[model samples]
Target chain A: MDRNLRAMASAAQERGLALRPHAKTHKCLEIARRQIELGAAGLTVATVSEAEVFADGGFDDLFIAYPIWPSPGRAERLRRLAGQVALRVGIDSVESAEALATAVGPLDVLVEVDSGHHRSGVRPADAAALIEAASKAGHSVRGIFTFPGHSYAPGAPEQAALDEARAMVDAGPHAEVRSGGSTPTARLAGTGPVNEIRPGVYVLNDAQQIELGTCDWADVALTVHATVVSRSGNRAIVDAGSKVLGADRLAWATGFGRLPEFPGARIVAQSEHHATIEFGDEAPPARGDILRVAPNHVCNTVNLADDLIVFSGGEPVDRWRVAARGANT
Target chain B: MDRNLRAMASAAQERGLALRPHAKTHKCLEIARRQIELGAAGLTVATVSEAEVFADGGFDDLFIAYPIWPSPGRAERLRRLAGQVALRVGIDSVESAEALATAVGPLDVLVEVDSGHHRSGVRPADAAALIEAASKAGHSVRGIFTFPGHSYAPGAPEQAALDEARAMVDAGPHAEVRSGGSTPTARLAGTGPVNEIRPGVYVLNDAQQIELGTCDWADVALTVHATVVSRSGNRAIVDAGSKVLGADRLAWATGFGRLPEFPGARIVAQSEHHATIEFGDEAPPARGDILRVAPNHVCNTVNLADDLIVFSGGEPVDRWRVAARGANT
Candidate 1:
């Protein structure tokens, strides 16, 4: 975990980009503190509740990188969060910008420009208008940001980084803090107006990262320690399933998760508490045998766990609470 | 929730089958209490930790329906729980049966037969061998159970129920309390030797249940109240995503989740905190608009939430803690 953190920190520092590691992956106070100690500019969270959790933990600067629509209750929470820390929110629409300003008064905002993920955010041309709208609503438009989530595909990281840079550049003069980059595109984010990168999964690279060629198996720091409960021939059922490893299989994903030790094993079926793994020519695991299973997505997997059992030199070390887990308000 | 509970309770009563609703769905003590009041025989849980949670809540009769391979720590927990409650656990393998008996001492055990799911459980022919092994190890063999998880498909419930009953009947004379049934197959169970139904999701029908023609929209007791965060054309991003609604998309699932208010809309894509919905010929939801979404699978969804906001006639009444939300041991 320290190696991955330092690698990303130095990589960002080398590229002259501010590292605002997304806290949604680890959601651990200790890891966040370590990131800050290693010179992370700030933390990037996904929700108001998450920001509140981190703020309560003494991390001052935080950014909610999603285009959040503040309801009456969330507005009050956002207001309280802004009063405690340097808060930056993502804005992709004029209506939300106006609503947020009205609900919580003027705040630090970033115009979200879509760079081909097409999940959220606005067009590059629409960034200036939304920034103007947010500015008109008495909010300070710090800059623009994009997700580049399309980089999650097998061979799409470099092109996604290019797209992210192009989108930030095309968004015109509002690119002061051109924030972008997920784990896949973070290293390739030096070009164009991009000045900040928020990579969440680099701290705990998972099966997806390894499969995407973004990180190697040695770089993975988090794994679900599962026990083989039942076995028939090469098929074994592990206790850690979607309930622990999470059920976030992408269209291109080979299986629900991957067995790091048994490279030929594939988790073909997963229920809430049982993951049925089809093993290759390797000897099948017997009942009660413990196995380290890598989740497809670290973010979802971490969200499921209450605490991470930190390991050092093949020994159990400490337990880090997933403090902001289930804080998805 | 009351209506759905009453309906399932009465359905089980009519068939002369004990209704042991799986507590893994709600994970709420308040709801579990209500289930007991509605004549549910006992509570069925997925994990030893979950069983312990219910046991701690004062409910005595409990069953861990998975083929659990108890570690030393879990074995101790099981022994403690067995002393506290009328505990019964499932066993599908001779190794696990002997291990469980040796680790926790003689306890009530159920031979798990593979009805049709093929995920866990031994074959019907192998059930007697497991039961004999448990009995020989000085444990009380308490009949058998099967999941019939294949009932989750669109047109497979009836056949799955038949398979469950047939498997139990073929498992020999040890079938005293033949336990089976999921939400889809609960109503269809009654033939052969099946005498108990462990339907988890019947209390809160989700999009999958409705899609499978198992339950109606009115039967859906649980719905995630989310806000529209971003909108572009017909696509609107909601606050609830895979983190809250869960990411269990079966092969035949229509979408990630269903918006009850806008039946035409479909949750096309979901990130950790964002669900992009594509509206079908309906007025696009504006930012900050609250929408109730029924998840693809209620069990996975309930596990993600910290609490369930009880609504009495459209007004928030109480907050029930998800007591065993992450009790996956």
Candidate 2:
């Protein structure tokens, strides 16, 4: 296991907060099993297909943290999942709550609360209405959950977590599992009503984490090992491209991806096969020099690989199959 | 097979042009079989993994049309592919030509001549040098190929095709297969020095094609059938997201994805399970209404799905497994 992940798990344990480590960032059963063994209460999944794979791999307690819509095929799978394990799903509307009642019977669902993501989820004030709807629909509403996605901004996680926790707590008697904290917000998510934290990218921090001053480069356990294929003066091209490190360049992101080993080196452009790098001061790496690239986002990066070769020191110890790698639907 | 695909293939046949369709778009053996039956000359692949999948499925004639850098692993795979089928690879640089000869042995390679994409491939003037390098390395130099990628831009395909044809013809003896056409440029590509045309997206015209005035929405064969999950007054959320339709949204692209069936509806944002939709004078679709979304880029969209539920007029015809769906690296 990566030392950084172990330390993060230790921190969560010390805080008496149950870690429901999100598996979307590293969609490997090995990592999930490790996290569970290290004292994660359950695993957090982004898709029903992911939950299905994890459950098949003996993970009984799982959370499909995303506010997923239940298609007829998907609803059947959810019902199957409910029968197999202690399953918890996310809901944000009365319509969805009604559909869940009709399709999957009585279910334990967390009302998705918006903490500033403005993407999905009901507003903090709207949580009571959803809870009422879930109750009226005869579903077991467990609690409320919100993502501190704005925590990516400077000095936002601590404040966002505080606000998120307050929202969950203020949502009355139904709100119980006050889920909050991303990787960036985990450390700042002080003990409060927040009982569980879903931090996916903490296992393998990215360029965003490094830029946010949340984690050091050494803390990033997983990286795309690429060989230098083109060299031109102080510039060179690495073999890893968008396919290896996903092309998710956020507004605040430094580049397409980051080369943590090579500090200040910028990946200016990415073709399908070549990732052009501009060295700050150090001489360009020779052709065939293996460089470790930390992707801008780990979730999309894991989606790109079929298998992960886990290494302790330089020796390859184990290979983890990305079983849920392409569960897009 | 979709009727539009058959129509497009027939249109090419009428113009006396051979369609060696690019299979990187769908990456399905079933789709390739349909294309071949519809009068396609052979198959074109973007990566070695794609070629391997197609070849293993009894595709005898394969063209790896990308300007691939022959790394040891890729070269070894290519050598195996050469032994299995009638293989023709693409080369843009003299170094790559030399490397291909050493690794893949003597090979029939297409000298990649630049059109307007400016991504991979050598300039037309540089084509002779690359071909000479291949000949010197004791490799069978086939011809030259160019992609009119910039043809996706407004009114560029016609001029781009002319430029590409001139470049190929300028190479003189080295230019045997002056390939110059994408879906957008296929109509402009005439029978001159250009012996073959590689147009992949024409098989499944996308939102990009429709916006580029290359094809009508009705001509688009492949559409992601998504159901509305969440609805507000102004914006609604659908099940199709980046994971399904892909996140390759160009700056000029009108929407994240297009709704061919629901005219004037556009996808504004895409999360993993939610696609935020913004309607333009179009009646808002009710929750559970299956919207047929035409992805902006069909190649990457197909790469996301495990299998394509091929539909012939609202009924499931066949389930085509995307053999090379997640074959990244």
TM-score of 1: 0.99
Residue-pair clash count for candidate 1: 0
Which consecutive 10 residues in model 2 chain B have the weakest lDDT in total?
B171-180
Best by DockQ: 1
User: What local lDDT score does residue B165 receive in model 1, on the 0 to 100 scale?
Assistant: 82
lDDT per residue (tens digit) for residues B203-285 in model 2: 77788888888888778888888887767666778877766776666667787878876667778776656788888765577
lDDT of model 2 at position A97: 91
Error of model 2, residue A219, in angstroms: 2.4
Per-residue CA lDDT of model 1 for A1-329, tens digit only, reads: 89999999999988899999999999989999999999999999999989999999999999999898888888999999999999999988888889898899999999899999998889998888888889999999999989999898999999999998899889854467999989999998874579999999999999999889988889999999999999888899999988999999998999988888988889999999999999977668888999999999999999998898999999998988999999888
Range of the 10 consecutive residues with the lowest summed lDDT in candidate 1 chain B: B168-177
- Candidate 1 stretches with Cα past 4 Å from truth are none
Model 2 chain A, poorest ten-residue lDDT window?
A167-176
